[model samples]
Target chain A: MILKNKDVLGLEELSAEEILGVLEIASRFRAVFDRPVRSVPIMRGRTVVNFFHEPSTRTRISFELAEKRLSADIVNFSTATSSFSKGETLRDTAENLAAMKIDMLIIRHSSPGAAHYLAKVLECSVINAGDGAHEHPTQGLLDIMTMQQRFGDLRGKKVTIIGDIAHSRVARSNIWGLNKLGAEVTLCGPPTMVPGGLARLGVNIEFDLKKAVAGADVLNVLRIQLERHSSKSFPSNREYHRMYGITEDVVRTLKPEAIVMHPGPMNRDVEISSEVADGPRQVILDQVANGVAVRMALIYLLSGGDPGALGVGQD
Target chain B: MEWSWQRIPSEFLVTGVKLCRQGKLGKRKGFLHVRKGRIEGLGIGTPTVEGIPALDGDGLVCGPGFVDLHAHFREPGHEEKETVATGSRAAAAGGYTSVVTMPNTDPAIDNTGMIRYLIDRGKEAGLCRIHPTGAVSPGRDGQGMTEFGDMVNAGAVGFTDDGSPIASGGLMSNALKYADVLGVPIITHAEDRSIVGKGCMHSGYWSARLGMAGMARAGEDAAVFRDIELAKAAGAHLHVAHVSTKGAVEIIRRAKNEGLRVTAEATPHHFSLDHSRCRDYSPLFKVNPPLREPDDVNAVADGLADGTLDCIATDHAPHTVTEKEHQFDQAPFGVVGLETALGVGITYLVNTGVMDMGQLVQCMSETPARIFNLPGGRLEEGAEADFVLFDPACQWVVDADGFQSRSRNSAYLGETLTGRVSATFRGGRLTWRDGG
Candidate 1:
């Protein structure tokens, strides 16, 4: 079955079969990255724009690399260089881009529903890179891909996400994707950083770091956004690390085979210890590698490339 | 003449309408004889007057013109959004004859001259009465008090720092005490800034799921509690604007039970719409004290039914289309409500069995009038004629382009509502007629 939706806005909108369909296609794209020549002509004539309204390092470059590998024409726009700095609104910018007949727009914005808004207003396919505390579908898919590589089927697997859950788009997207895959998910953070209302979404809310880390098949550690703490969500970075950080001692609580994941630019010793972030149990780099594959698969499917054709010419 | 619109016949007979006044609809169809700009005669049955113009009001409900305790005209500064003239036309279209304009303008209405300017503009428009409220602080900075007595003498109905809360409790208490001496209520745009930092919508399941910053209900409830306490201590009248949370309603309910002079008003959006409307992240649904959950919606409706909420205020805030076109987090907070308030009230409140039609009219007209101590809440003889004729069951979809207001940023745009105002009259002159 094909991916039915035109936009990959969020995992929440995707069904289980649709998600599994994306993962299966993404694994084929992952194989292409290992070839001597990584580039493909699947999207040769397609034009995709990387519209980043928020500052980013990894997500923007990952998407650009994916577009280049797929042989798609790419134009980049950031808030600093775009007409948006001169008061041109999102609608005007979108309309202008539509006028150019671009094939897809991968948007990273600071507004939670910016991607959803563009998806409604634009005719071309829309991909959400990251929207303020909202969903990062590609990141979610890549994290899921990393997990699937370790454990074939995620059903009944314990996945604990620990960090500033209140402000993490990564956490939200992972929660939706994991929940749909039948994984038992637990969220661990300070009460201020975690909203209890999320418990209604069929996830566990645990404040204790050790209890949450124990028996977890995977731990997705989100960055503690220090800039968002003007309201004092936690006392200090030191205090947060001591209380909820995934240190060497805390990592020992997990099973010997359990993995740790991070969507980085890591905070070093903030949310995760430097040792755990670089250790064998951590697959953070693998997650990043999978991000490019996941994005390539999405752009291909949204461009109407057949999933059956994805297996062709890979030998 | 400034009153050129009033140059109709000296007397007229309104026939075959159900008259609602002081929270009751007349048992039979009635006639109202308006003479010399006053209700010369009003009762059940056909009037035996000869050679007088008769206005047919068949299948229509006539009630006192609605009085709004909160609205933002955006004149003398942001006329691109709205002016007194345009806002009056919109108000008249929505069956309102008297509106209390909020003081959060470019240069706020802090002095007597600004108040007079609004009053004169309303007179020039000749559509509705504009009662301006002076800012509680000079610039609404929440630092110092304005000249409440001087502005009140120059026709200000009340005082408020409406766009933002008075952050200091001591300042709020002092303003309440000062306004109490002038016998005017100190209206508060109740919200705690610290708790509401950068929050654009209600903090709940939708917020958690959407991943946007959520404005917790405690921000509103805490501010309402503080203001009520300050009002109680000052022994003054305090009116809460846009009561959206159930906790705030319960707080106001208890304050009234204690016989403290606390009154509150709910907006049409608060009682009808909820946070789910913000799912699309459209700036149209973004408002201060953002649309809450279903429980809060029901509580606001219940508050209006039980007199915990004293009136229905439109809170008709208008912003430019360009302004509303921004991202939801970047867009200004407001929705133009003057044209859809009555329809929303009927569709959400009356049709849901939350309150009867007469009670709705009373909340819109009489209660608001009495709360602000304004005139023209009744259709009694010798009183100047001020009333609205509406088809209570008429269904019409809201189209923003058809609005009389200058701005098109309305929350109810494209929504099919259950009631429609056909005409409005003030001082025996027709101010607005539907499809005109």
Candidate 2:
């Protein structure tokens, strides 16, 4: 039931067993990343390019780290340094990259359907790192992996993603992943920011973040994108953070053992306070570590590599 | 220059002495010349007026054409829906000499730059004069006010957040204060969000029977009530846009009676149709300020008749076929009104014995011009010659495929309508003429 070598373009394409298979493979790869000898030869002699058109130090580095750990040669193609300045079409750029014998492309673009466009045009396997506030599949997978590692299973877990749901790729991706993993996800933010009918996606929704975060097994905080602020989506960053931020006081209301997580380059004080982000119950760093392993698993699984060959002894 | 005194055509002889000056003429005897496309003169007999064609104006009312106070010419950003050129042509065909375009585009017209862009693009199209409305809030976010003075200075005729209601009262009040200072009207699309959440069709037995979400009348009334109070508090000119419900009509009626500087507009659909039309779950029947009960339609008709409703504005919301071809709740609200408005007005108001043609002209032409401070709604000389020549007896079917708008989103498609516009003139220039 593993994903055959096709474009992992959207969550709609995945069956329940395929999703479970990805998670199981990701869990095994997570154990491999913790070992002293972290690198593998699963994708040896193959190249994976991280073509991130948007600004992201974390997702890019995590994918690069994952590719390097899987013994795949890594090339970073940032929009700042790329031929995007020369007005090369995205299709042309992707074709040029694929022409270099690149086996896979990990793409992040600032448009919702950018990655899907590349996937359609190129012969190489395309993994969407992020696509314009749409979905970040690896981040969602790693989040599920982190939750599974902490709780032994994601089944029946109450997971809350609080803040900027309207502009969060993380939220969209996580909703799909968590729903598939049998976790009851709750989305909480300002009513304007929290999309309507998320309950239709099998998720609970709340505007009051304080009430939403309580009794949750995982409190995943999403970053409020500043560009969205310029569009007047929110009144102000300070005002948004005041009402919905994961403060030390707010965290106190959660189950004592419940973990707080953020996909970082943390707007540490804006979304989650320094105290809570760096707190004992915080899995912020573990999520980052799990990101590389989960991505390694994604690349390995999608490229026809056997999941059991990773040496974690799969069921 | 040659002047000729001719004891000429009897029609001219009876009207005046046949004294002909260069280019000073009327009909066949008097001469009217266009020198480099500018009107040189209009009185004398001259045969040397080369390349200046003349039409015999026997019984035709020749003056500056018509102007529309409200038109949703979706363009610049969402051309898949409609463009300025197509919309302008539609306006011209409808006998509109000028159109005050709504500000609810993709990158909503909230700033001076977007406003300038709209003006520039409209001018380049050269079909009719397009005066853009500035959004009340920046990007119509409803959180803060846009620079009203900047937009006003940029030749914005009015201010509105037409697609969505201004959700915040404080911000709306502040916007009104700015409008008060500038002496511009704040046109509000009054729908309180709390009562209207995700409901597509109008609230009534039809919605309940169809198992569809019903948009309540309170959604519009609550906000209209709030805006009327806010307008009174600020003493600002408030224009209620597309007033739909009986409750809203009563409130606006009271406000006008109290001598509040408040005016309201009812769209053609509001006066013509009611919630019963939505019983089949037709998305075409869907609109914002969702079509209310028959009593509401009756109230709107009374308002239009009694002058409580100041004008009949076509909230001509155009959408692409793909955008409209969805389930009742999922499809976008609004139907194309520019092409169907006059016919609907004729059928529902004029034919029903509720109003005469003069009253229709007063509401549709005179009042909107006075409220928005635009010229050319009147047919007087020296004013922009803006007027629509309608047959008043011609009947035609509403055909979406034949419309000039880029989108086929008209709710009235296939429905037969009365009163067709025969010709439209703008600044004494023929912009549209029905086939001879």
Candidate 3:
């Protein structure tokens, strides 16, 4: 089935079937990576613009590589390089881009609803790379894809997200996507960093880090956003590491088959230790690998490519 | 330009209208006899006096014109959004005859001269009575106090640092004490800036789900708590502005029960809308004290019904379209409410059975007038003929384009409302008529 939406703003708006459909397509795209000629002509002639109002490294390159592999023409705009620095409003820039008749506009803004705002103004498809602490839909899908690769079925899986759940858009998107896929989601963080209101979203909030990771099927660790001004929530890096950090001791509390995940760039020893970063059961790199496929699937589907018809011509 | 307070002497009889007055709706259709600029007589039935032009009110409900205790007439500064003239026109269109404008202007209305300038501008417009509020601090900087006595003498009805909270407790206590001496309410914007730092919307499930920074309800609550204690210590009237959280309502309710001079006002948007309205990321919904959860909406509505909230103030803030067009986080914190306040009251309160029309009118008109101790909330013999005619059942959609205010940044834009104001009159002269 083709994706019904003109924009992939967030995972919160998508249905379970729609999410699985994108993941299914992503699995097929994931296989294409093994081939010598990984490039596909699915998005041929379509122009995609990567508009990063905020700084990024992994999500941008992953999307760029996804666009290249899908054969879509790509143009990149970062805050330092774009006319945005010249005091052009997002609407003004979006209007100019719409004037150029681009196919899809991928935005990464520091504001929460920046992507949603542009999607309403532009006739073209819009993908949210990361909007404030809101959602990173493709990242969510990639994380979900990585989990499904390990456990196959997420139903009844205890996925514990530990860190600044209050400010993590990755945690939000994952909560929505994982809850839709019937995963039992538990949030673990310091009291100040974990908002109890999220419990209304049908997730359990656990303040104790050990109790949160205990017998968990998957542990998705979030980075301590020292830059996002969340430093006031906890005392220091040493205190946070001592209290909630995912060290080897914390990882050993999990079930033998349970895996650990972190949406990078990890704060090294702050949120997760180096031993756990390079340790077994941590699928951090696999998450990065799946990100391209997930983004490629979304771009292909939102570009009106048929999900059922993938690999038919190229195979 | 020449400005005159004197209106053309007029004689008219408003007949066949349901009159709402003194916390009750008249059982029989009545007629109001207006001579010169005051109500000559008003009672149930036809007037004995003849030779006066008679206006057919039809099935419309006539009540004392609404008095807004809070509005931002962006004048002497941000004229691109709203001037005193345009804001007064909007007030008249919304069936308001008197509006208390907030002091958070370009230069901040902290001085006596600025207060007089706004009153003169209102008279120049010849639409509504404009009562300017003085800022608590000279620049609303939450620092030292403004000269309350001089500002009040210059026709300032109240004092507030409304766009931003009076962050310091000592300064707030001093402002309240000084305002008490001047017999004016110190209107607080009621937010703890430290708690609400960078939060664009209500801190709750939606903020968590949307991934935006949440403005915790504790901010408003803690600020209200502090302000109420300060008012108690100062023996002053603390009028809480835009009381959004249930915690704020409870605090105010307890303070009122203890008989501290605390009067509070809730906005139409706060009572009717919720944080879910921000789901679209529309800056229109990005109000300060941000549209709260449904429970808070119910609490506000209940607070108004039970008199914990003393009045319904529009907090009629206006911003330019381009300014509001920015992303939600970057957009200004307010929605234009001058034109939509009455309709929202009727639609959300009266029609929903939360309160009857008389109570709603009392909240909008009489209580607001009493809260700030303003004139013209009563329709009685030998009083200035400041009143409004509105059809309680008239269903129409709100169009911001049709607003008389310079800006179209209304939260109720495109909403279907059950009431429509037909006409407004101040000082026996027609200020606004439906089709005109």
Candidate 4:
């Protein structure tokens, strides 16, 4: 199965078979990560531009590293360094990049519909990095890949995404991916931060941190994103940590062998303790490594490239 | 005391004689002086009327201008929908001397700065007195409360999370308590999320028949019930917004009978129309706390007549043409109300003899001011001169194109109405004059 060269704007557009095909390709790429010669010439001549209007070091670096590993020419355009400072509109910048013959454009903007807008306007295949606290599809795919690599299969495995969910694009996208893979995903956060109607999305929601993370096969901790905090959300970061943080002591409360993961640049000492990020049960580094392979799979799948030789796609 | 008699034409005399010192000179006769536009003088005996424009008093009656407890002047962001100036002009032409604007704008009025900005804009318009309601939550997000004390200090007449229900019980209770401390009311757009599941119109035969999602009456009733209990717990006041259900009316009636500090308001659409009007799948009939059944409309009218309902609020939500032109469920919920409220009230309530003109004035003016604790609701001697001159019998067809509101989404367009405003005065100045 191959994805049409259109926008992967949301998870709702993907069929179960298409998602499995992407995952299969990601699994093959995951195996390549262990070898000494890990680079692939999948998108050798393709120019991938990482255009991030929002701040995220980990996501940007992951995409850059993923493109480099795929041998694609990459240009990282941070909002700070771009013509956005010169009052260039998002459409103008995207058109400029498209005119430069960029084959695949990965965009992250602070507005919710920014990616969809770019996808509609630009001729190249557009991948959404993150859009204002909405779905982060690539991060979600990477998370599922991490889980699938560790557990062999995710059918009926329990995964808990813990922390500020209302503002986490990661949790939303992960919920879509995890549920598609037949994982029981529980979203836990302070009531103010966790979105209502998660049950409508076929996910369990809990306010009690201990109960939410208990007996989970995987725990994905989301950062508290201090800049997104309005006055109404919480009294203080210390208070938030006291109630909801995934500290080492809190990790001890989880299923003993459950892997702990954080979409990094973690708010260590706030949302997740540094001890857990470096602990024996932690696969946070594996997530970073798998990030490239998963993104490469997405880029190849969406760019009309075949992973058939690796036995990833049926046709 | 001595007295003199004079005769004048029927149309120009706008006065109501309040008896002073009964049995003096046979009857308690007082003359009201109207000079230019302001009330120049009033005398009890030997009418010493000077160079003031005095008109005849024959079969006409006069009262203070009406005020609306709710309106939406969708300006600043969606001006293609409604502007403050046009909305205020519409209010004035609808016999409204003042209107309380809901705070669900593009950027919600969650702070004193936004409140001041709206007030300044209203002032610049120089029409009806625009008293803005501040949002109870930041951006009306419903997670927590905005600075109620600060909003109150900045002259927000009331607080509400209109266009969105405050889903959290804790937040609603806290807001009520905060408003209680500040001696203000937290007006609620009472619709429970659990019951209102993306509904477009009132749940009834029409909704089931048309296959459109229906906003159940349970939605409004459930929230009204919950908020009443929460208000009791917090010992605070909760004003139900756009009360459209009989069940909600019953709850508000019982709460008021229990001596709870509670008030409820109904929109003109609720008492004048029902769900059957939505059979055409018209977007104008779509409203949050949607138009209920005919029985509910009657119950609402009864509630208003018997003092169960405190005021008639015009939930005057305005949407752009593009926003309202979608399919029934997809289009926004609301229709323009500020300009149509008085005509609807007169045509439905007054003409039907269900409620007299005095009761209509009470609901639209006196009671709204009393409920919100505003100052200008009376036509007394020293009171600020805010009044409306309306032809009580003039019938006109509603036309959106001819409306002063920026948005042309009134559900009542083409509906025949019995009364129309001839002029409006705010603070003794003629702010709006029809056919001027």
* Candidate 1 interface RMS: 2.7
Per-residue C-alpha lDDT of model 4 across residues A153-247, encoded as one tens digit per residue: 89899999888776677887887777777889999988766655456678888899889988899989988878766445777879888988888
Q: What stretches of model 3 exceed 4 Å from their correct place?
A: A80-86, A306-315, B1-9
Lowest-lDDT window of 10 residues in candidate 1 chain B? B1-10
lDDT of 4 by residue, B253-342 (tens): 999999999998888999989888875556788887788888999999999989899999988888877666544655678888878887
**Clash count, one per candidate:** 0, 18, 0, 1
Query: What is the DockQ for all candidates, taken in turn?
Result: 0.61, 0.01, 0.58, 0.01
> Residue-wise lDDT of candidate 3 within B1-436, one digit each (tens)?
1212243337788889989987788888999888888999999988888876788887989999999999999898899989999999999999999999998888999998999999999999998889899999999888898899998899999889999998889899888888898899998888998988889999988888777788999999999999999999999999999999999999999999999999999999999999999988888999998999999999999999999998999989888888887888778889999888889998999989999898998898888987788888888999899999999999888887789999999888888999989999999888998877
TM per candidate, chain B: 0.98, 0.86, 0.97, 0.90
Superposed by TM-score, candidate 3 places the C-alpha of residue B313 at a distance from the truth, in angstroms, of 0.8
Q: Candidate 4 deviates by what RMSD? A: 13.0
C-alpha RMSD values across all candidates: 2.4, 13.0, 3.2, 13.0
Worst 10 residues of 1 chain A by lDDT: A80-89
Please give each candidate's TM-score: 0.97, 0.53, 0.96, 0.55
Query: lDDT per residue, candidate 1, A118-138, as tens digits?
Result: 999999999999998989999
Q: How do the residues B106-202 of candidate 1 rate in per-residue lDDT, one tens digit apiece?
A: 9999999999999999999998888999999998999999999999999999999999999999999999999999999999999999988888899
User: Candidate 2, residues B1-436: lDDT per residue as tens digits?
Assistant: 2221221111111111121111121234433332332334444344354433344432332223455677788776888787888888777766666788999888898889888988888888777888899998878788888888998899898899899898899988988888888978999989988777756767665553333455778898999999999999999999999998889999999999999999889989999888878745466888888888889999999999998998888888887665554435556788888777778887889889898766776677767777888875764323454555565667898887677777677778888888777666555455677663
Which model is ahead, 1 or 2, in terms of DockQ? 1
